[model samples]
Target: MQKKSSIFTATHGVMTTEVGVISGELELRTTCNDAGILTLAITYVGAEEWYTLPGEDYRLHDPRDHEVVHRMLTNVLERT
Candidate 1:
């Protein structure tokens, strides 16, 4: 498996005025097989906790996976 991570800041604002902020992190991990099947696990930066939105250790077969993950993370940040 291969892994990469990054820290991200989510900010809430209205009409150019900043209202709130949340620090978020994302980790992308992958494993591939000889048959070309790829599995992706998306988690918080350090915890290695798999999220339900992107699936619990989701497969990389769907193109919408990235967007779904992004939305889930955004929701988490906003609610914090």
Candidate 2:
């Protein structure tokens, strides 16, 4: 599995598991398994616990697209 993480500030709240919505400095984690399945999670920066992003898991037709997907999500979620 390949896992990537990026830290960003969410000017608008992001919907997440358990916590409902999270804002401010947060970390986005994208995990890709051998089967090209992707799962996304987020957490407060420096926090040990991670929360799953609602409706964020899916299968990628190309595993190499993981990096691009991760970058896009980071940019979109950053807001400003």
Candidate 3:
């Protein structure tokens, strides 16, 4: 079994789970405006994985996911 340990920044408004076997981790971009201020909400979608109870680190058996995630995120960010 594999899991994630960190929230890797996919882009300005998107984020992805890092150090996990499961791939295709994408987050929707949401913005909130209040008092003329804006806040971005990165909502992650797709599969779900759990980490150790006492720790926040996760394991990824398939290291390929990490590379893919980075590539995908970069492409999306560049487009947007």
- Candidate that would win on TM-score: 2
Q: After superposition, how far is residue 57 of candidate 3 from its true place, in Å?
A: 29
How do these models rank on TM-score, best leading? 2, 1, 3
lDDT of 3 at 45: 56
Per lDDT, the best of the predicted structures is: 2
Candidate 3 lDDT score relative to the true structure: 0.35
Supply the TM-score for candidate 1. Answer: 0.37
Candidate 1: tens digits of C-alpha lDDT, residues 42-68: 455667445422334444565435445
Error of 2 at 72 (Å): 0.5
Tens-digit lDDT string for candidate 2 (1-80): 99999999998889986989889999999999878999999999999999988785599999899999999999999976
Error of 1 at 19 (Å): 24
Residue 30 lDDT in model 1?
A: 47
Please report, in order, the local distance difference test score of every candidate based on alpha carbons: 0.41, 0.91, 0.35
Q: Look at candidate 3 and tell me the lDDT of residue 80.
A: 33
Worst 10 residues of 1 by lDDT: 13-22
RMSD to the true structure for each prediction, in A, is 9.9, 1.2, 15.1
> Model 2: runs farther than 4 Å from truth?
none
Residue 21 accuracy (lDDT) in model 1:
21
